[model samples]
Target: MKWFFKILALSLILQSFQFSDTNESPDLITSAQLETKKLEIQNYINSFSCSESGGCNYIAFGSKPCGGPKTFLVFSNSVNLVHLQEMVKNYNEMDNLHNIQTNAISDCSVPLPPTEIKCVNGICTIIN
Candidate 1:
């Protein structure tokens, strides 16, 4: 009987913290949005001209790229797409690169472009 009461109390506590999901849309990235994001990235790359004997490293918390520190131009052939999505799982319910939705307002400004963006490598990249 003690165990039963303990279980009931725990259940009630958990239920009190639960929130309704109605009237909210999932903020997952769609194919069309992804394509749009890609185009935006390409445009940023062109504007910065990072490929023409210029090298820059971009950080993507999820698939979205966030610009890190910049250095002098150097020769580099390929762009690195490091998937830091797992590292960003804690922010899954927040906006930007992780692309999740919740009632919580973001404390950090990870610009969700196409929603919000910032200059990375002298180019604008979506915050994720």
Candidate 2:
């Protein structure tokens, strides 16, 4: 009877170890989802047209694991600049959070911002 009780206790302990907290938060965004968001933002930026260099502009985009933007995105003033800025800001914040959660590592190299943005064939292009 003592042996039976010992075995039961061992089984119970092992069963407890099998259980885990699988309740992941719904707000958690995965890398794949972030990529999708990026593509969407790029498509939106591409929708705008520019006829003059003065209408072209650039915004720092994406967060590096070590801090700073991963790159810059060129856009035209024909876009809703305020809305685009908000979207990019949110994206950067989300990306930063993802890096923290995943313990991401990077080369820690800082990306240089564009020297100028120019309208080329109705599209905003980055000039470095």
Leading candidate by TM-score: 2
TM-score of each: 0.28, 0.77
- RMSD (Cα, Å) for all candidates, in order, is 14.6, 5.6
Q: Each model's C-alpha lDDT?
A: 0.40, 0.89
Report the lDDT tens digits of candidate 2 across residue range 7-108: 999999998886557895547769998999899899999888888845888899999999999999988888888899999999999999998888899999
> For model 2, what is the error of residue 37's alpha carbon versus the real structure, in angstroms, after optimal superposition?
0.8
Cα-lDDT of candidate 1: 0.40
**Pairs clashing in candidate 2?**
none
Per-candidate total of colliding backbone pairs: 4, 0
Error of 1 at 91 (Å): 14
